[model samples]
Target: MFAPRVALASLSGESDADWAKACEHPAGAAFLGGVALDEPTREAARAMVDRDRDEFLPEDPVEFVDDQLSALDDAFLRAGVNVRTVDLDPLREVTEVCASHDAVLEVNAHCRQDEMCAAGAGESLLRDTARLCEQVETASDAGAAISVKVRAELPDVHLPTLAQAVERAGADAIHVDAMDSRRVVRDVSDATDLFVVANNGVRTREDVFEYLSYGADAVSVGRPSRDPEKVRAVYAAVKEWFL
Candidate 1:
């Protein structure tokens, strides 16, 4: 019921003010993402974000990440950010935890973090299809809108299979990371049936519109603060740009 025409460029670290701004895009209906994970610099990052939005610590992602992700999901949803959840084993813990908090869950296969992948998360899902599908069904059964975040690189990445599998898994949407290129989007279109929420490297309204041209349901903001003063400025400009 939100911006079927426009969406924001979302990422790991975002603010409620960011969500407020992204939604103001006359074209934007809602935002995606549940703030950033506990990065290597949690304290420093925490200071940069609004106190209410989820922020993580600087350490090897431990089981503690599961609770952090759950807490973030709950916090953002209450703040009205349409928070999307991510965790180590989206199948093992994130799905249920997100559902408990009434938040959306995504299988984050697009994470490029080396430490994440080494721990059997992130892009690791792309390696074993059999396991991935099982996990997809698991998340889908939990009542969370399942999504798969991928680079949308073809030949190099099996986005089509991943997309179909995600759909079969009962996902409500697919979050495509286009890496600032339209070709990447075409690849995702070829794979899934669910609506698209385009992401990654978006710096302008034109890029947002470009995704709309390809049937993307919405876009996410990569770097806009939820600060009251600046957030609305960016949202207002984008609103005018698309309308």
Candidate 2:
């Protein structure tokens, strides 16, 4: 009910117990952290389900989103969690799958990972506004609130224009990954009208203040390593600040 929501991206694992630990944090409403598809074995996924480390289920881009949603349904109760996924061509497959599970759908334009970009998801969408609008319209038309997850642009791009276009294209929210302070950093105030959700390169209570100061409706995070308490704290903070 906060102005913005806090969610975790790319969560994965082979064990329900591993997933239970992450669910323990109330702020982690949506979990997406996972290991590479080429390595979804229990041994590799243990970091995600057990240690709460960032891991993805080894899967093709679209399949990865499906796999995560499937695992979430099998791993947790629907009433307790609003699950979701991120992948390439999610409009082609993953979104339908999410609707079936009554899960939320997210388009990750923030992943700067080389392997992910090559797959044609994440930040690559930013490079092609035409495709970006297509993806947003596709998901939005499906009765889903398309969340455009993007990182701060390279020093050369127009940040405000990019943020505005996402909203103009029917995106319900804008996810700004502020991991590279030197490169991709967003001032929450820059996003007008759009629900600006801060993400990435964030691991502390103070880091969250940066978002609120800039008028971010909410913030998302995955740095469980920085502090096991961080996820819970963020969730509580968003509700406290906005709701």
Candidate 3:
């Protein structure tokens, strides 16, 4: 529900308050850390780091979220956090912090890391729709405008159906990583009323237009988010097209 309708998707270890501030201008929404909340998820994050993968493993995750949002007190764009955890208990507290900051708590069902899946987080949630919806409902009940980050093209996972289940579970938005199967954006868009934010390979204005044409309410820039020029170009594309 942002003006230009472009979002900065969360990067594993890189996305934080400073990162959000740096890229906040042109984009309408910026999602912060894919922070690992519970112990299992945090331990998996450590394993990822051992493999040279980036991750956010703060000692006090709920407090970390508070500090991150507090640092962005003056930012004009909406801010959110993409969180991962195996247990549902932590979401309530973390989401409360998100609500206090007027931010969205994005449940991460999109991550594909083997470690994350083994911890029963990330893409594993895709295979377990019930658990994913429960996570959504947990955050939603905590007074958060919750969003669920989901990826398409996973085996046996019908995104449209998953989208419907989440919508029924009180999610406000669906951040779809339309990996390879771009039409999944349209399918999910067609199936539900959730605000759809399409992601993946979004580098140019044309890419922005492509996702918009597929019925995406907004398009997110992932890898090139650090490239201000590219993010600006995509933002300009959305502004120009929407205007």
lDDT of 1: 0.52
Per-residue lDDT of 27-75 in model 2, one digit per residue for the tens? 4345343323222222334433454544444436455555556666653
Candidate 2 similarity to native, TM-score: 0.68
| Displacement of the residue 54 alpha carbon in candidate 3, Å | 1.2
Q: Count the backbone clashes (under 3 Å) in each candidate.
A: 15, 16, 0
TM-score of each: 0.64, 0.68, 0.98
After superposition, candidate 3 runs with Cα above 4 Å error: none
Q: Taking the tens digit of each residue's C-alpha lDDT, what string does model 3 give over 147-200?
A: 999998878998999999999999999999998999899999999999999999
RMSD in Å for all candidates: 6.8, 6.3, 0.8
Q: Could you give candidate 1's per-residue lDDT for residues 167-238 as a string of tens digits?
A: 776766777877746665666775667777777654565665577667666565556434333434444544
Q: Residue 90 in model 1: shift from native, Å? A: 7.5
The TM-score of predicted model 1 comes to 0.64
Stronger candidate by lDDT (2 vs 3): 3
Q: Considering every candidate listed, which one attains the maximal TM-score?
A: 3
lDDT for model 3, on a 0 to 1 scale?
Answer: 0.92
